[model samples]
Target: MKEYSVVPNKDVTGWMVKIEDVAPEKLYDERDAAIAEAEEIAQKNKPSRVIIMDQNHEVEEERTY
Candidate 1:
């Protein structure tokens, strides 16, 4: 399974979804590039909403009941 990490702008007023992932050097670089590209596209389009989806992989440690 593949996972993506996303970071949205701080303002939260625009439609931009940045997606990234942990991987080899080349793939990581590509992911960064992809995020920049997506930001540009969202800025131009100005959609009503922007959503970022990432795979759930991390396991949450259980607390004592």
Candidate 2:
């Protein structure tokens, strides 16, 4: 199964959603938006799970698609 993570963007003032096999992380203005984006990516890659990280980059939640 693939994995996607919604984490904070250290280089900017927002969140990011990155997939395991994909380069160039997607940036988002909101954490919830980032999670939503992760969900979308996970949906596209069906057998994947989305991980939500806190501000400190700690895994806070996970959803399997």
Candidate 3:
């Protein structure tokens, strides 16, 4: 399974979801939907930006022998 990152716009009106392995073929439509949803959830307390880090980016610690 691949990890994804969801970052909201600076205006706090929408969010951007990105995945390393999966590139969105069309982001215009998706962006609209995501924005609408975020706005609804955020309501009055909208977030300036939402950043979702990809779990895949997490690196495992290596032990030196």
Candidate 4:
């Protein structure tokens, strides 16, 4: 199974969608955008899940595909 995570950027000024332990290639200005992109990716790649993290870097919610 694949896993995606929406987490705040290193500077905490933006959000990023990371696949597994790979580094995020893009940063989203909004958390919602990041989540949306993550969900879309998860949908494309079935048998995957999305892990949403809050600003505090804690898991806020999870969605399985």
lDDT of 4 by residue, 16-50 (tens): 99999498957999999999999999999999999
The TM-score that candidate 2 achieves is 0.85
lDDT of 3 by residue, 1-65 (tens): 23333444455444455443255312323444644443443343333332232224332221111
Q: RMSD of candidate 1 to the true fold?
A: 13.9
Q: Per-residue lDDT of 1-65 in model 2, one digit per residue for the tens?
A: 99998888786589888878365487889988888878987899889998888988788998999
Which residue runs does candidate 4 get wrong by more than 4 Å?
none
* Error of model 1, residue 47, in angstroms: 2.5
What are the TM-scores, per candidate, against the unseen true structure? 0.32, 0.85, 0.29, 0.94
Q: Candidate 3, 53: how far from true, in Å?
A: 6.8
Q: How many residue pairs clash in each candidate?
A: 0, 0, 0, 0
Residue 46 in candidate 4 has what lDDT?
A: 96
C-alpha RMSD in Å of predicted model 3 compared with the true structure: 13.2
Candidate 3: deviation at residue 5, Å? 1.2
lDDT of 1 by residue, 7-41 (tens): 32334223233323333222223334644544454
Where model 3 places Cα greater than 4 Å from the true spot, the runs are 21-65
- Candidate No. with top lDDT: 4
Query: Candidates' lDDT values, in order?
Result: 0.33, 0.84, 0.37, 0.93
RMSD (Cα, Å) of model 2: 1.9
How do the candidates rank by lDDT, highest first? 4, 2, 3, 1
